[model samples]
Target: EDQVTQSPEALRLQEGESSSLNCSYTVSGLRGLFWYRQDPGKGPEFLFTLYSAGEEKEKERLKATLTKKESFLHITAPKPEDSATYLCAVQERKTSYDKVIFGPGTSLSVIP
Candidate 1:
């Protein structure tokens, strides 16, 4: 069975603070790892895609990296506007149909 877990289900940070959110997983075969940000009452916005181990992607104050069994999202100098729920998802190569398993997100709150 494939399973994904995230730590510190919620985070509270002062403006300009930096932190890293962790996502650990176990899958039969990993095809891709994805990162997304979701705002209240909105759909998730794609942040990054990692195809293989050691792959990484970055956008503004966010960086996403992948490994054999886990992934990380590093937030640098976050502002109040950066507050959102960060999501981690994975695609399994063994599945016949395109199926992505998502982890419960890490909700981040940045206080100004």
Candidate 2:
């Protein structure tokens, strides 16, 4: 069975601190990887989409990178407004269609 796992169930960082969140997966055939951010009482917001290994995407203070079996979300100099739950999802090719697998998510709190 294909599975996605995220580490550090929760993280607290001071404003302007930098850190990286991890997402690891096991799948038969990978199609794509996705990153999302969800604030309290809100739906997940798309952050990045990675198609192949060594691919990287960046937006604002966040950067997403992918490898053969893992993905990383690096946040540089985060702010209080950046507090949210980061989600990692993977799309794997199955027999007839693509299956999207989501990790439990890492809740991040940035304090001022």
Residue range 16-82, candidate 2, lDDT tens digits? 9999999999999999999999999999999999999999999999999999999999999999999
TM-score per model over all chains = 0.95, 0.98
In the order shown, the candidates' Cα RMSDs to the true structure are 1.0, 0.5
Candidate 2 ranges beyond 4 A from true positions: none
Residue range 31-77, candidate 1, lDDT tens digits: 89899999999999998999999988889999998989899999999
Residue pairs in candidate 1 whose N, alpha carbon or C atoms collide under 3 angstroms? none
Task: Assess candidate 2 and give its TM-score to the true structure.
Answer: 0.98
